[model samples]
Target chain A: MQQIKKDFPIFKRTINGKPLVYLDNASTTQKPIVMLKVLENFYFTSNANIHRGIYTLSEEATDKYEAVRKKAAKFIGARTEEEIIFTKNTTEAINCVRVSWGEKNIKKGDEIVVSSLEHHANLVPWQELAKSKQAALKIIPLTNDYTLDAEAYKKLLSPKTKLVCLTVESNVTGTIVPVKQMTALAHAVGAKVMIDGAQSVGHIPTDVHNLNCDFFAFSAHKMLGPTGVGVLYVKQSLMEEMAPFMYGGEMVESVKATSATYRSGPWKFEAGTPNIAGVIAFGAAIDYLSNIGFKKIMAHEQELLAYAKKMLAKYPQVKIFSPSQKHAGGIISFAISGVHPHDIATIFNNEGIAIRSGLHCAEPLMNYLGVYGTARMSFYIYNTKKDIDTAEKALKKVLKTFKL
Target chain B: MDIYTETILDHYQHPHHTGALNDATVSATEHNPLCGDVIKLDLKIKNNVVEKIGFVGNGCAISQASISLLCDAVEGKKISSLKKLKPKDIYDLLGVTISPGRIKCALLGLSALQKALKLTKN
Candidate 1:
């Protein structure tokens, strides 16, 4: 774990005269030096537009860009590279599905089911879609312990349900939903399921085939890649059925003055000059994570989560919102009595420990949970027990500062 | 330097002029949706001068303390003088260098006060 910390240069820096203790992995992971080198080398040596120029540079660039698609497919257990469509970020990827597949399939009086654990990126799009189509948006409720009510989800599914969107892991509560079982239930009612893998892909083992989800969206930046690249994996058959989201440039098969037929496969959704360098470097990020292996990464993160929970348990003022260890991942969201999350975050910042505060882009969930916001500490492969100790000390400073 | 100074913490712990005015002539509320901080200001304006002022809300120390300080600064002052108050004045009142991220928290009180002023004018 200490060796892994060295791979990220940011960990070496000092903030407020203290060593940086970053616990905001769910927001965005720090870029590895390997990923940085790949991003820089791509721009330095192979800077060209893909699928446009007939020159060698463009062809090489296109090959590198497309290779990442195949790597992403293999990484997530997609059936083929043709299933992968590169978007700007996870939000854009979900919007792609909303515009292309949703507008066509979702009709008036239909139903769309999402969980109470959804980030705004997943919830708001579907809410807007339901509003535009005059459809009903249903929510899968949470148990008292914060895990999803799978029984309630089964009852919500019916023939009228056109789509079911589920997150593989909750960013705020750290609850890991049983997506495979839920997807099967959705498919039983002929509803297509889309999994938001933004918090799951790099942290846990993800297999689109095992989950049997029709569409999946994730951001590369959350998994140590550059900021501008994201992946949308549509099942191959659905890929053929969906229309192009953005219509321009290489996405077209042939252009005429009047009308044009779009390209087949994932290229249909990628319009304009895409983030070529970001895509190629995302491939390197995948390689770096693969080399470490998910088993080690998960073990490392789980250890940190357990340690953090144990440490936090010492303070009676602290209330944890994450599910039990068996049902959750590396995230630990909690609130200290009489202390606002923003105050907690400011105190942690003074100690050079980075944590997230506020609604976490899950306002509805926050309202449901009956807290205005929460202080979240998410762990990754590089985070150590010592980092958690630093955070614990900073948390003490928060209580002392506030006289809680 | 830590943005949370002793004065900020003191104001947060024991804020001045807090509560809803029963006969408030004008009132306005402002929310920082990013962190879910909300502040509501109530004024008892008489003859275009501030007769009394109070604030109530739930938020971080920066925001609560800011509103508390703002309430102290504006009471008994002329309405026109209150209009001249700027963000720098709030920072000066804070007695600490506020980061860009916390500037909104520091100025949330100013925002609500301005809105209340607008309501009174109308």
Candidate 2:
């Protein structure tokens, strides 16, 4: 399928007369026109504080807001609506687990296995949790091809392991992990699994039930939804002891003279006035993505990755750090031998092809790859072959400017 | 032709005064955690006079080149003189118009030097 360029208004703009070609999907995606309209319609028509409203508008807002929970549940293959909790973002969701679930389960001397390829969102909370609880954090290293070494991960699992927190895909390298097989391994050793789907849930088919992961966290913006909204899917069987990530507002079921009791289901964890418009818009985004189908999106991205690889190979100075397309997702992380990645990005900006160049929020991975940072070119449903041609021309400008 | 000019690229490719001082009187390291850019400055001072100054870092071209340029400009100069150096001086030395996003990158080495000079006096 061709990119519906008109569907995104940003594609109509130009930088110095150069048409815009957004190549930063790994960072965040440009919202479609339909998504924008959803946000507007919610504010214009159905704006009200949900779950606490008594009027008709409030009830209508509440219905639209809670309906997204069901959509998100089916989107991720969660067993029921009660299993989904709306969070501010993936980072907050992971932090929620660190405090709500991790504090009660992980004790001193217990081990948590995490891969080195995780973003700071997935890595930092576990590090802090392990530090505060005095637990052990075991790391799984990446192989020669930059994919997580599954063989090495098997060695890290044991009865002493209490949790396995990792990303389903590495945002920096776009390497997809075998989360299903890894979750089964964690389960065999009586360990719970938490999958950071910030980079994978929207790109691939994620079935929390099939994977059997106890917890799954993902952001909405990564999947064509609105920002400031994310999801945390907790298995119903594990919810008996789960505490609210925050405690206030409608979260408290009843107030008493001495003590208070909180509500059951996901409402207990949602402790404030939710992002009503963002959630409703995110629900619309879910329907939009489902309509396109993951199969079409994946196949289109695969084609983009292959074509970009062939074009990059022509330049001897171009050095790619992402694994081959078979293992890699849609991102192409690379550096031109002598030129800095930041320089390449500035040059791309001039060419109107937006790309990201930095540590990409995965500093430990940068340490592993032995580079300061890499320039990344990512693809989504909106990008097309013509954008690749523009990127090729931009690369030529960069090499010429650097005299490489 | 733009920010990545010939002089900037030359310094980035072949940085001057890049290494650690063995008997340095003062040293400081600064990092931009937002993008993981690191710059370390080592100073050798003899009775308030700048005897030797060197740096080491792994960052963007603007940051790395700015440090290399900073080292060359401050060598053999008094530490007190560097205390009054302003951001504009580095901008002029780099010979490029830095955009708002990269202002921090251009000033990373300067900040490290300013801190290192302060520590040397103490």
Candidate 1 lDDT tens digits, A53-85: 999999999999999999999999998999999
Q: What are the per-model C-alpha RMSD values against the true structure?
A: 1.2, 1.4
Candidate 2 at residue A289, lDDT?
89
Candidate 1, B-chain TM: 0.96
Look at candidate 2 and give me any clashing residue pairs: none
Cα deviation in Å at residue B41, candidate 2?
Answer: 1.5
Worst 10 residues of 2 chain A by lDDT: A1-10
- What lDDT does candidate 2 reach at residue A327? 86
- DockQ scores of the candidates: 0.82, 0.64
Off by over 4 Å in 2: none
Q: How many clashes in each structure?
A: 0, 0
